[model samples]
Target: MVKMGVEEGEVMQHSMLTKSIERAQRKVEENNFGIRKRLLEYDDVMNSQRTVIYSKRKNALFGERLDVDLNNMIFDVAEEIVAEAKEQGNFEDFQIEVIRIFAITPEITAEEFAQGKIEGLTDRLFEQAINAYHHKIDAIGALTVPVLNNVYAERGQIVENVVIPFTDGIRGIQVSANLKKAIETNGKEVFKSFEKGIVLALIDEAWKEHLREMDDLKQSVQNAVYEQKDPIIIYKMEAFNLFKSMLAAMNKDVVSFIFKGEIPGQETTSLQARQVNQAPVKTIETKAELVSPTGVSEEDVNDGPKEPVRNENTVGRNDECPCGSGKKYKN
Candidate 1:
């Protein structure tokens, strides 16, 4: 070893313990660096996923072509339906699925489906599904636009932007759109906001869950080293799988919510109005009226005869009688 303060050409001898300690220190540093490098590689995987998710969220939040996105999703779902049915060679199942998802019966008959090519079937179903969805929106607009106009006329206010309520049974979100645009598009413009809200909500929820899963995965993958496997490689592969599964689930949920979601319609509004108009109004009781002359509230007094309380230590069915009968309690 060469001492820092030694002159040129001078060498200092160190004990064996000192050399061993220096080697251990260097080894510890290398181990730490390796750990850090592994961590960086893991984070790189997450960074890529984060970038993808945030990009989607941004598009949903501010993009102008959300209808195009929705159309693509609709087509993808339609394609999936057709492909599954084709794989199973079941036209009945295909028709059922189309009705279930799109609320429209397929125009193609069983024979036509049996003879149609996969690409042709997919395209045909996509066209039908998209058209049905548009018609459904137009029908809703037919109901909603009149109601909106009525309200605006009564209020004597100009219509600009309007907030529409959409629900997926469990979750409800309010989406805003330009009334003029919605009217021009026959309620398709309002659905753009619907798609935007649904996409954003699903993305946020799925991304949060994905993060938690990734955290668990990170901790769990640490044990891979004990199995004589490279932890980083396992983590990367598993993380990619997890990400793909997450994306698939998110997309499915978005499509399902969009198709199955309920918008408040004229019938619902009228039913609510009738219910409100017919509901009986009850008068609130005053505190003095609630109290009896005995200074106790009528509700506090039970009018019925009280039942006797049973003792907790009552004889069990198998216990000997307390009357000295030397028989079981049941007997």
Candidate 2:
């Protein structure tokens, strides 16, 4: 049921086709076939990457081994941070990024990591991140139910006052205080739901960003041909690097937002589509006439025996003037 674009229902007809007609229609123009072959070549490259992302999304949606997935996300974040720090030859900026986003202070420093020969750097970072998370959970204890219920109650009251129209067929429901109290009483399950939401939201945001960058690269990579470079080769290399960066970003964003008690919103990563509609067109009319060397009018020439050649015979300076009103040819 997936379609490239919406189609009018009137045009969506399925007709019975005979075997003979089907075979005859298979004879495509060579040029068109070649064009499609080239198109698929580029599409194959993107398809492979798209498959991996979609698989990940399916897993998240189906709640498959979610706890293990969360653990992997944490490790991924740790590894990415360590890798970046290693590349930059310093951890000051790394620490700053982590602190600013996740609100966690790592006791380990870049200088210290260098001193330790970079051993167990990832483990140390993960431990610090986990500790920060656990501390937040402990702080929310006992008062978690009461706090969540109060927030949900306020939201329910607002929903009762505001009239929201139904979309398609279904209308969104506001979180009621009773539902919130039930969730709070359910204990760890409620928080697990929150964590899952955060992770999926971050993954979606990061993937969208990666797709946007890839699209931009696809559009502009042709400029490489001016330098006698292969655009496909350049695209593949850049895409690989971009995918790696996307994974790292997803890992970092998920963990950071979860620890910060926030969900990544559309405002964080949404991109506006640029429209290039055709400009308005205007048409103008003008009249043109040809004057013959014999001083013949355009209408007279058209009405003559045949079309007159404008420059067939030249008027020499010593010849009589072709125009009857002229005094001399050179005058």
Clashes of each: 0, 0
Provide the lDDT at 39 for model 1. Answer: 81
TM-scores for all predictions = 0.67, 0.55
Candidate 2 C-alpha lDDT tens digits along 1-331: 3374645663443455465556666665666797788668678878998897777676667767776776788877777767777778776877886686568888886567776544388788778877777776555333344434443454534221111111111211111122333334543433455555556666787888888898898888889999999888888898889988787777766666566663123311211111111232221111112445677767775784875678778888977899986667998
lDDT of 1 by residue, 5-94 (tens): 778787656798689989999999999999899889998999999998887888889975566766777777787888889899999999
Error of 2 at 261 (Å): 1.2
User: What C-alpha lDDT does candidate 2 achieve relative to the native structure?
Assistant: 0.60
Q: How accurate is candidate 1 locally (lDDT)?
A: 0.76
Global fold similarity of model 1 (TM-score): 0.67
* Poorly placed runs, candidate 2 (over 4 Å): 1-28, 87-91, 109-111, 147-186, 262-331
lDDT of 1 at 95: 90
- Top candidate (TM-score): 1
TM-score of 2: 0.55
